[model samples]
Each structure stands twice: as C-alpha cells, then as structure tokens.
Target chain A: MWSWVAHRVTGMLIFVFLFAHVLDTALVRVSPEAYNTVISSYKNPIVGLGEAGLVAAVIFHAFNGVRVMLVDFWSQGPRYQRQMLWVVVGLWVVLFVPFLVRHLMHVFA
Target chain B: MSTIEAPRTQFRRSRATRSNYELWSWVFMRGSGLLLIALVFGHLLVNLVLGEGIKQVDFAFVAGKWASPFWQTWDLMMLWLAEIHGANGVRTIINDYAEKDRTRFALKTLLLASAGLILVLGTLVIFTFDPCPTGAATADVPSFCQTR
Candidate 1:
C-alpha cells in the first residue's frame, strides 16, 4: 500500500519539479534580465532546501520506476515482486549518498 | 479490478505483436526512464556540482549552456521524456482511482493539455533562445548582453 502511495507521490513531486524547471529555464528565451532576476532568487536557503527535497523525490521515483519496469517487462517479475522492491531500496540508498553529501555541502556553504 | 472476473482460457496474445498506444506507452516508460537517468544526472552534475555549484547557475550561465547544440538536445530530450513519463504515470493513477468515466476523462484531458503546452513552449524556447537580440534596449538587457 505504501509502495503504491510512495510511487504516486514521488511521481507527482518530480513532475512538479519538472514543470518549474522547464518554465524557469524557458525564461532564457524571454529576456536575460527576466531570466537572471528569477533565477537569482533561487540563491537562498529556502529554495536550496526545496531542491534537496526534489533530489529525494527523484531518487525514489527513478528507483521505483525501474522496479515497475521489471514487473512490467519480466514475465517472472511478479513472482519476485517483494525481492525486487528490496533491490530498488538498496539501489536508491547507494545512488543517493553522494547526492546527499553534495547537496548538504552546497546548502550549508 | 477487472470488471469481468471470469477465468479466461485465452490471453490477448494477438494484440501483443501489434503496436498500440498502451504497448507504446509501456515501452516508452522503460526506454525514456533509461535515458532520463543519464540526462537528469548529467544535468545535476553540470548545473549543481560543476563550477561554483548552484551559485554559478544564473542567467548568463543558462544562456551559454543553451547556445550549444548538445545542451539543447539534452534539455529537449529531458523535457519530452519527463513530461510524457509523468503524464502517463498520472494517467495510470487516474485509471486506477477514478470510478466515474467522466472524472477520469476530465483529469486526463487536463493533464494532456498542460503537458502539451509545456512541451511545445519549452521546446520552442530551447531552440530559439537569443542571449542578445536586435532592437532591444541595453538598459533592460542582462549584463552579459553586449550592445550591437
């Protein structure tokens, strides 16, 4: 139950980030002044924290997406669904450590 | 839950060989996801870890990145993959939860429109971004924008 919820919530979270990223990045086409003004606001601690949250969401969504792929593509995947979930968790942690360190360092620096 | 709970001796093997929307969607998720990992990680590494980290990601920084074909293609690919992947995922959620057909249709319609709008606008911006344009006042331009 939680896995389903987590997958959905993370998917939505990453989606929101994607939306904002595109819109903000598109500001480049509008005018340099507009783009610079908007992006400069992201320099603060609040947005840094939000970026950290986004990283977490991406980690979970990507790992779980692989798990979903496994279940969808592999004929025998459903039989080992429980095992696959554990593998996803393991992979998420392994992938996330470096990102965590980098983000924390930048946020506090 | 399947509306019909009857045990069917036959599976839709015939439909398996033919390419359809659902089939394409399934493949898209896996294929796009594989690409997304590379694109997203490269993006994070370049934008966040390289140079002065987040501090270096200002207007000129973005303008420079987009001026290159590589970053443009990368950003475009990321935009399409992430948006479609996200929209498809939400479509799944809607199908699972929305008992009323009308509600599901409305939600999906909204999702499709928003995703389409962003995809179009983002793609256009990526390809057409001009750091310095003709006839624009120097005062309103970014510091990096030199007068012609």
Candidate 2:
C-alpha cells in the first residue's frame, strides 16, 4: 500500500516536472529576451529549491523502482524486501547530500 | 528387458509459463534504463553546466537550442523513454500488489488515463509551442520577437 502510494505520487511529480520543462523550453521560441527572463527565474533561490525537490523526486522514484522490480520478479527478492527498503533509504541519503550541496552553491554563491 | 520397461516414470509439471509480454517488458526496462541514464545526464549537464550554465538559460537561449533539430530529438527521446519506463514500472507494481481484480482494473484504468493524457499533452506542447506571440504589446514580447 505504501509502495503504491509512493509510486503514484512520484509518477505525478515526474509528470508535473515534464510539463514544466516543456513549457520552460518552449519559451525559447517566443524570443531570446523572454527566454532569458524565464531562465533567470530558474536561477532564483526559490527555483533552486524546486530543482532540489525535482532531484529528490527522481532519486526516490528510481531507487524505489528498483525495489519494486525486485519484489515483483526476482525469486529471492521478496524475502529481502525490508533490507532493500533500508538500502533505498540509505542510497537516497547518500545521493541527496551532494545534490543539496551543489544546488545550494549554485543558488547562494 | 521386462524390468527396464517397468521403470518408466511420470512427467513433472513445469513451474513457470512462457510469456512474451513479460519478456518484452523485462527487456524494455533494462534497455530504457540504460538510455535514460544517458538522456538524463546529458539533460543535466547541458542545463546545469555548458556555456553560461543555469544562469544563462532564458527565452532566447531556449529558442536557440530548439531551433536546432538535435535538441528537439533529444527532448523527444527523453520524454518517451522516461514516461514509458515509469509507466511500465507502475504497471508491474499494480499487478503485484492489487489483490482484487476490480481494484487492479480500476488502478490500471487510472494509470493508463493519466499516462495517455500526459503523453499527449507533453508532445503537443513540444511541437506546437510558439515562442513569438503576434499582436502582443511590445513590452510583453521578447526583444527578438520585435525584430522578427
């Protein structure tokens, strides 16, 4: 149940990001000046935070995806689901630190 | 000869059935995963690194990039790969966790609807996007729009 909820939520997040990305990129067709303005908005600290959120979403979706695959298909994976969940948590923490740091520097510095 | 003839044994049942859908799905997951890594990383590197980096991205920048067929194709590939990959992954989860047939059907119905909607909307936005709006106030238009 938790997994289903998470999958749905992450799917939604990715979908939203995809739409935003297309819009943002589409702005270029409007004119270089408008494109620059939109791009500049992306550099704002708030948008930086949004980028971090996007990263977190992708990581969660990807790692949890692997876990789902294992439980569904692999013969021995169900027995280790709990262990895999922990690993997913650990991996997220590890990956998120660098991501946070990089984005912070990009935003603040 | 009589003793040998009496030793015939019964055949055991097979544990698993063959499925082309399952095989294709498995292949797709791995193949799309590999492609996604490249598409995703390239997307990141370009947006976050190349040229003036993230700060340099703007309306004109985007227009310039999309004017080239390369970026268009790249974005298209990423869109299709990620959507299909993520949707397939969700489908697998639905099959595994939903115990009731009705529940499964409902969830899958929603999933398909959402995926279809997103794919259609996304593709439309990509191909039909107009950077320049005609008859807009000059101030509202980008500088380049004025020149054109």
**Where is model 1 more than 4 Å wrong at Cα?**
A74-76, B1-19, B134-148
- For A1-109, candidate 1 gives per-residue lDDT tens digits of 6777998998888887777888888877776677778987887889987887787778787788788878888999889888988888888888777777787687678
DockQ of each: 0.53, 0.21
Q: Whose TM-score is greatest here? A: 1
C-alpha root-mean-square deviation, candidate 1: 5.1
| Cα deviation of B56, candidate 1, in Å | 1.3
True contacts kept of each: 0.67, 0.25
lDDT of 1 by residue, B53-99 (tens): 78777766776687679898998899898899989988998899999
Clashing pairs in 2: A28-B63, A29-B131, A30-B131, A30-B132, A32-B60, A35-B58, A35-B59, A35-B60, A36-B58, A36-B59
Worst 10 residues of 2 chain A by lDDT: A25-34
Q: Best by lDDT, which number? A: 1
iRMS of each prediction: 2.3, 4.8
Score candidate 1 by lDDT. Answer: 0.81
